[model samples]
Target: MPFVEMSISLEGVSILLKIMVTGKVVAVGNFSRYIEDSRKEAIELISKLLGVTIEEAEEEVNITKGLTVRKAWLKTWWSPNWKSKPFTYPPVQCTERAFLLYLLSYTLFVDKSGSRVSIALLKLLENLDDVGNYAWGATALAYLYCQLGSATRVEVLQIVRYLTLFEGWVYEHFELRFATSNAKYMDQLQPRVSRWIQKHETVNVGDKLA
Candidate 1:
């Protein structure tokens, strides 16, 4: 679905907001409120749009709630003095696979767009799992590249290779130390990294063997 921008008056001032609407269902920026206010309407809308049963729509709504909670936990986790106050924000543990599926549904199916995952979600995932694990990083990268929509097939393959071999480890081990650190370096380096990966993959094995 396309993002629809609307202007509203608040206290005689104009504020512009972007919302995702599928059919008659509108998902405003405040997801929680939208869910609370239009729970039934949303479920009906989702079921009609996606051709899913109401039960499945309910499940998707629940998964979205989990995503919201996890996002909040991540903000606390990445905050200053997080270690000193480990209990400041308790973790909300759900099946990582479930979260991933919900993320795909929310971004692709519901939003119907390839916008980057919210920063809160990204930070949460980066810290939630072990780097050696492929699910979190791989899924995140795939979503990112999907949003970018400009990566070549070779570039995608290279990014997969790079993440599988190196990037995940760096994030898990070193990047979490500082709150305001270069946490988004990989995103910034995406273009250059894709180029490097493409070049590296194009080399002929026969030439090397010769």
Candidate 2:
């Protein structure tokens, strides 16, 4: 396995994040020679070999290295190519995950400035509902939230609570159902049955629900 070690610093605080690539390497022809190259070169080589954008290739490598059997299975299940020969995952799912990972990777490894972090967070909020629909989506969203600095995490949580009041909807997933619940005093969610209201209102409003 090959790995990349990266450091991100914000204010006076520093954090480290790792990108690991797992699996045996079966290099053919001249490709094997580049294995000993520097990390930057190695990343470029991997990008070219995989025929993916550099960011996409990097995300794929990290996901492949870190993904468990269950996650891989869910990704495969959500993929549009599930019925195709050789199997292919859904591009939309891939793109969404890649974007999330990119945001996380950039924030954790490249820049941790306030403006950059805010932009990334807004992007997450904007796509919050769509990302929640994917298998393991809520988990991914939570992971992204955890990556933020302490204060930012609290702010994001508050924003998520506000969004849940309007945009949240119930799903088959227990995590999501539990998240969007709104029973108030009964250990339910906030705003008192917001998910129920959102569902009914969505039905009544047709496509106007936002």
What are the lDDT scores of the predictions, listed in order? 0.31, 0.30
Q: Compare the candidates by lDDT and give the number of the best one.
A: 1
Please, what are the lDDT tens digits per residue for candidate 1 over residues 1-210?
Answer: 111223111210110101111122112333245445555655554444333467955776576552232222223333435345434322333234224424433432223222222222322233334322323223333344453454465554332211211222233334343323333434322321221222122211111111
> What lDDT, from 0 to 1, does candidate 1 have?
0.31
* Clash pairs for candidate 2: 79-90, 181-189, 182-193
TM-score of 2: 0.20
Whole-model lDDT for model 2 versus the true structure?
0.30
Residue by residue across 17-58, what tens digits does model 2's lDDT show? 111112222121332232333333434543442234578545
